[model samples]
Target: MILRTFGWSFAITALGLLAAFLYEGTTALGLVAVLAILEISLSFDNAVVNAKVLERMSAFWQRIFLTVGIAIAVFGMRLVFPLAIVAITANMSPFEALDLALNDQEKYAHALESAYPMIAAFGGMFLLMLFLDFVFEEHEYEWLAWLERPLARIGKLNQLSVVIAGGALAIAGGFFADDPGDVMIAGVLGMVTYILVNGLGDLFEGAGDVDEDSEDVKRGPNGLAVATGKAAFFLFLYLEVLDASFSFDGVIGAFAISTNLIIIALGLGIGAMYIRSLTVFLVRKGTLHEYVYLEHGAMWAIGALAFCMLVSIGHHVPEWITGGLGAGLIIAAFLSSVVRNRNEDGKNQSSADKELHSSGV
Candidate 1:
């Protein structure tokens, strides 16, 4: 199972290392490896959330995610995305942006950084909403009941996640960012974008519901139907936008270590392949269903990351702080899940033994 699942990750890592070494010798190789590791550490929670979505997608779409979707992730997001951002923000052509990224990388990095407020506000608000919706939903298996109960209650209020996100944006715009108007505008746009995507995803989800009357649906003796068409397309779009939001932080943070666009792309692209593989593995292996609190941890990690991104607008939040908090939350959740599993097993075994004794086995 491990080998079947991680074959691409291994191939990609090997090829990335070889390319890195050949391009700029050992120094570039080390940088690439470090950045790849950093990307994995920072975005591990993203994989968890992605699995939840990907599992709902049709098998055809899942294949596309591994093949076609990966190309978009590596070339489109890792390479073209920063260039597009530079083109838009710096008022240049695609070729000129390419020149800036390759020849005057510090300037390119600066242009990207100059647009941080907009990126942070947008990505942060979207992530904040995603996290809020997840945790605030009532779950029978509450990880931290004391805190989650109140959050669930608060979530019962109409459009509470939006309300909280908007309030956060207001606080940020009023007191945090130097350019309050731009920040607020970007934040509002982000929130609106999230609502659109969320609604679209919800619509697609509704469409995916099983209809016994529909002749288009193929079924086994079990009479289950598959999801496809417009639903899958909208879900794909949602996943892509979600990925872009996560990449905003990574691309920005990579500059702190190196400004070479090739290095950044290769490094982060390698890690992205692994992240996607992890998403698929989680789905196929039923990791989320097996580990009850895993989703809780990932959501909480996202909340922390969202807060960090928002704070980073005016303050210099370190990568370690952002990444570490997220990793820590996920690790804690996994550990708690393990402990819960052991306890459950013990109870079941005890119950079995008692029944056997009573039965005179």
Candidate 2:
């Protein structure tokens, strides 16, 4: 089953390596290899978070995530998004931006570097909100009780996330951001985007009415069409935003390694493909269900990444540190989950033994 899920990831990694080799000999190939590994390590948490949302999606949408989603990840975010950023920041046409990226690589990289503060601030706010929303909400299965319970209680207040996120933006824009005005605008937009996407998800969640047969479809008010179809579409939009929030740091960090967009696309794209596949793997194998505290761990890692990104606006936070912190949280969560699982098994066995003794003659 694992092989069936990950087979394409292995195949594509090889293809990506071959493409890297052909692009600029062995050195470029090694860089691509390193980038791919770095991307995967940094993004496993993304896979875990994606699994929670995706497990609710239908089979058709899941397949679309693997296919249509890959194209968007590779071409849209990896390629066009950077070019658009360069174009906007450098005050150049798209063609000019492309030319600068191709010919004047240093100038293009510098433009991106110059824009980092605003980008980091925006991404930081969005991710921070995601973390806060998760932690502050009521979670029945409390992994970190002392930590989570406090946050959940705070989350009970209306518009608390909005207030918290706004405060975060204020701190970021006031102290850390390069151009405070621009960074504030970007951060506000990021927070708004997060809120809107989450709101939409809340709106659409009832469309499917998963309590009923999830596969069953009902007609909507506007037309005789299926209600679930509209719901699924909105859910997809939310998931895409979730993906963008996760990838923001990765896209920014890739430039630290190489400014070659093609190389960046090839490498990060491969890692993204694997992450998507891993999302599916987790859903199919019930990995998230089995590992109870995994979601808590992923959210904590996201919070850590948000902190690193915000700090990077004022100071340099190395890629290794960002990746390492996330990996550590996830590992700790996994270990904690395993211990809980074992304890439950032992309790069940004890109960069974007690029941047998009580019934015996």
Q: Please tell me which predicted candidate would have the highest TM-score against the true structure.
A: 1
Could you report the Cα RMSD, in angstroms, for every candidate shown? Answer: 2.2, 3.9
Residues 1-361 of candidate 1: C-alpha lDDT, one tens digit per residue:
7887789889999999999999999999999999999889999999998887877776777778887888999999899988987898889999999999999999999999998988899999989989988877999798878899998988888898988999999998887898999899889988888889888877766755656444323332223344466766777888887887887789899999899999999999998998989998998888998898898898899999999989988987999998999899999999999999999999999999999999999
Q: What lDDT would candidate 1 get against the real structure? A: 0.87
Reference-based lDDT, each prediction? 0.87, 0.83
Q: Give candidate 1 misplaced runs (Cα > 4 Å).
A: 210-226
TM-score of each: 0.94, 0.93
How does residue 76 of candidate 1 score in lDDT?
A: 91
What would the TM-score be for candidate 2 when compared with the true structure?
A: 0.93
Model 2: worst 10 consecutive residues (lDDT sum): 219-228
Task: Put down candidate 2 lDDT per residue, 14-92, tens digits, no spaces.
Answer: 9999999999989889888877887899989888988888776666777778888878877887778888888998888
The total number of steric clashes, by the backbone 3 Å criterion, in model 2 comes to 0
